[model samples]
Target: MTSVHDGEATALGMAMEQSAGTVMIRAYVAPEQMGDWTIRVTAIEAQVEHATPGLQSYQLATDVYAEQQQARTWTVTLAIPRVLVAGKAVQLFNVVVGELPRLGFLTRFRLDALALPEDFGPGPGFGAAGIRQRLHRPHGPLLCRAMRPAVGVGTDTMVRLNRDVLNAGYHLVKDDEVQVFADNRAFRQHVEAMVAARDEAQAHSGERKGYLANLICEADELAERWDIVKTLGVDGVPMSPVLQGFSTLSMWRASGKCRSLPTTPSATC
Candidate 1:
């Protein structure tokens, strides 16, 4: 993790500095318009310092190559200042989307992926280690299942269903993002029910089981609910990066508030 205090956040310096501040984005451009696209990207690169003062522009490769998706793929790596992010994941989103939209090919371009430096955030806090730990199966395979018929089931009913699965030797059970967290199926009710179910399962099976509650909510409400889920003894949390924004996961990692907890990203992302 390169400290943002090392020097002024110059794009070139950061990009060249062990790839600390580099953020890679894959974009699609037309084969014939490669030259024009290159110029546009270069111009955007040049505008970085102006767009974000104190953050110097960095060098990037502009070679255009064809991909299996029938469009030419152009990988652009931007070196942004670490200070600007200040450990806030949303800043990464701003760094990427803020400048790229200025290009004329915005409509034709498709952002395929983002490759971030490890210092950026502790990605997928639980990951393989956390998942295995949650299952208490250090040397064996872990199991996971989601609550079916996604919606319309009451909180109590969902709890009983989850309890049954856990007692049946399932390692973990998660709620569908759409099933709860809405007006009718309140988050508090669902979390309380889940905690109760987990307790019952543990007492009955004599083995640990995990519950991944949906933490999908409006941005303003997420922090509050996340804390509640943790304090209430839920095993893990499931969130939709697309809906809640990727920064949400970043915040969870960078904030150090949920370091011990595991998070399950919505499969749709």
Candidate 2:
């Protein structure tokens, strides 16, 4: 049964419970429309409760300080059932904020915070420790460089840029997100060239140098791109999970095909 929490403290406690995921949303309402907002909130609550299965509870709270300062801040805390997400990124997003914008009465809303059950997705496939281990650096900062001149550069130029950076003692070098792959042939060639440059740098420096291929492409091309990079032995990949969609990234990480390769998430989010 769905329940409504009365206070932020209580809502926070519910948020930490193992059985559910919690999200805190902030909404702004005009002073003239307070009454209308109240009515809308009640209606939206009922609608959400009915439409969202595994919705355990929710709460609406006013920020007293913000109200005094005329900021009009109101917060909503939602406790959703854990089973609904099941370690899937898309499902987690859907259950939390997918239908929010269309619910009306909230011209301005922001997701302030989110708390997931401890066992979210398969965590990071190769996190910081894994990267450090692969690079043979137990501590200290690892220098990484992005192959720039974001666009309009040919494969040879990119290869030269990567080779220079890797040779300059940078631990990792990756393609800029904006770099275009005109076709599969072009992309394969780019990867091959970059990997060869990385190997050469590693050989000369007597240290491991990593190359991360940017895998931002058409949805249909993701699998092929992954196969190419994996087969060619690139150290890692730079991906835009936000642009690719969380589900695609999650699927790839959980697939175990690239378990040994570290993934660097691009700054698209």
Candidate 3:
């Protein structure tokens, strides 16, 4: 059974308890801001039961506040009842703070892990089985390469670099964290250049792909950046979960109903 502590406005250091059969849950949520906040806490099973000879358990949780608030926080607790530990191996959950849904992946179980879900885009390039089904190259691990551009590089310079990256057989790329500000390099120029490079590579060797550009704009002017990027056309944009807050990014991704998106880590989001 799934236990969801769904709510709108919340406060700090609030605790709750829940039980499913013999399994028990103790959730503590300490909200950091006003406006809307969403938090989730779940207990999962740990594998290697026979070797460990005990129940393995862990919890996943996060909190989101408004943009004006700067940052938000929360905590979660899961109590095991000796029936069946929540999980045996990895515990996965699709947590949604407002509209942005992030896949929470748990590896090593400790007291807790930061549930601050970063935007990996609206969703994966392909879902679990979907990636394997489409790319047909999913059995092995994947590598990620970030395009850390020179802070002052002009748009044209960055575009040429995109071409070089695509030529080097790098499967994926994303813009650096400091690459957004009132169009110093011009988002339009960057998108057009990268999209064209992506097309050219496909035209010859038939390797069709591109990179996710970091679109850093002021909260007051994010819409303008989105519109310009859409008009120019690119695969996706990178939003930071830490700096912008989760709800802001959630709404941004929601605005693009039919387009693809990716996100990076930051302070708020």
lDDT of each: 0.57, 0.64, 0.43
Instruction: Output the number of the TM-score-best candidate.
Output: 2
Against the true structure, what is each candidate's TM-score?
0.61, 0.69, 0.48
In Å, residue 239's CA in model 3 sits off its true spot by 0.7
Instruction: List, residue by residue over 222-242, the lDDT tens digit for candidate 2.
Output: 889888998999777767767
Candidate 1: tens digits of C-alpha lDDT, residues 1-269: 11111122222332333222223334643445332212111212221221122223232333331211221223344544566455555666655554543332222223446655676555445567766776677877677778986787677788789898888888888887676565423777778888899889988988888888877778878777877887788877667766888665655665675453323455210
Better of 2 and 3 by lDDT: 2
Which structure among the candidates has the greatest lDDT?
A: 2
Put the candidates in lDDT order, highest first: 2, 1, 3
User: 5 in model 2: Cα distance from truth in Å?
Assistant: 17
RMSD of each: 13.6, 12.3, 14.8
Native-vs-model 1 lDDT? Answer: 0.57
For model 1, name the residue pairs that clash: none
**With candidate 2 superimposed using the best TM-score fit, by how many Å does residue 42's alpha carbon deviate from the native?**
15
